[model samples]
Target: MSETRIVGLRTERGWTQERLAEVSGVTVRTVQRLEAGNDVSLDTLSRLAGALEVPLRDLVAERAERDDTGNAGSTDDIDDTGGPAAGDDAAARHFADAARSAWRDIALGVALLVTSPAPVVLLIAGADAGLVPTSVEVAIAIGLGALLAIALVATLHLVRASGRLSPFLPIRQERVRFGARALRWAERLEGVHRRQRTRATAVACAMWVSSPLPLIVVALIEPGRGQGLWIAAATAVLLVVVAAGAFTALRTAWAPYVQAKLAPAVEARATV
Candidate 1:
């Protein structure tokens, strides 16, 4: 069976595999397998296509074209190890720079979003614990102010990042021709990112599962006054831990995620 444009289509809309699965009513693993070029039933394909709002034929046809071009006997643009040739060094650099910028902005924005509530949480908790000489209403007002400011900053940053990728968006959406060299570069980039993502995700999962432990321990050990402060502190710590993990994972994954969407572009040219 021919491959599908699930990855490109999904990414074009800025949707993750989990998001796509949720919208399409399928398992995340199934979406992963499908994007990995595994075979699937027509019903499954139809469901995914419907969710992506694209005709099923377009998805299958797009990949078929790419497969054909990739299978063609063309090694002039490839090195001995099947990597991008010297001729493509400039193109690779340009693509890498753009991809890196977009990745950096997106990761930083996500980090901001996750950590945005930390200040507010800490402030409110501290006020409640009497550590800060402020009324609860005043604390809430200040916290909300901080939260809104951070949220606005993050929103603007992400929007700018998305705008910066306008040139590459077509390639990502598979609307333009992409060469084999770019595909190889994307594959290599993805391989490196995969390792980093694995480590970060594992760490994040561990942190998340243990986040509540601190609060639990504090509550159990101290059943008297000032316990609220400790509990609030623990909650603040929990948010920070979650933020760090999320930031690390997303930071490591962004470039590859964006580039991977371009990997399936039809390799009809000698260079990107």
Candidate 2:
């Protein structure tokens, strides 16, 4: 069957290939192939029809009618209003979800990293105070270490998963070479254009560098006679700076993907 009908129907409904694949429980690559006019099984067609909320016969019939009418045009054409195509909007929504998911994963990983050391510290303190038996403490320490290792691995996985969605986000190249390499690999997997990757890398580096400035300023400031007050002030500043930096990083990483998907609409508005 001709794929134009499927493409046309999907676009008309403002659905991206990714969105269709998700709703249809099919792989994105498979959707891409099917839309490229590759032959697919009836089961695949049925799934797609269900996802599109159309009957299988209607899909086939639409294609036949379009072929007979010879009114088919390129999907890239803008509408009469000069706005973005529905497919563009669909893409924007899909990537926006990915961006949100990536940030959430990052946040969860950070939380894991911050808490993973607590159990070890607690166990050591308990043993010193004779609250924990020496033998039991040793076993607990070993188990805690293993748990920490597992948490670290899970955190790294989440970070890598986020990198796949937001290839522009810095994965701490200086501190984590493996993570930086993973980010690069993810960028390639996501088919990020070379130009976009270069631009994103530059922006990410700038953001990462600037993010620490506030904390540095706090550190450099001379603490007056009240050492406790100074420490509290510095801690508060560090917390605020870290929170703001994380927020900025998330926004910066997500912006390009969102903008790329929305560019047509933005350009249309500008021309109008």
Error of 2 at 173 (Å): 18
- Name the candidate that leads on lDDT: 1
Q: Candidate 2 — number of clashing residue pairs?
A: 0
Compute each candidate's TM-score over C-alphas.
0.60, 0.37
Candidate 2 residue-wise lDDT, 92-205, digit = tens: 334455665665566556545544544554455455555556754594766488667958775785865554443222111110112223333334534554454456556645
Tens-place lDDT digits, model 1, residues 1-272: 34346777888899999999887657999888888877665445545755776644555665445555785333332233322222233434444665677766787787778878877877887888888899888998999899899988988878766654543433344443345666777678778778777887898788878878888899788488877778778887887777776666666766576465555543434444
What is the Cα root-mean-square deviation between model 1 and the actual structure? Answer: 14.1
Please name the candidate that would achieve the greatest TM-score relative to the true structure.
1
Error of 1 at 123 (Å): 2.4
Please state the error at residue 101 of candidate 1 in Å.
2.4
Off by over 4 Å in 1: 1-93, 267-272
Residue pairs with backbone overlap in model 2: none
What is the Cα-based TM-score of model 1? 0.60
- In candidate 2 the C-alpha lDDT for residue 215 amounts to 47
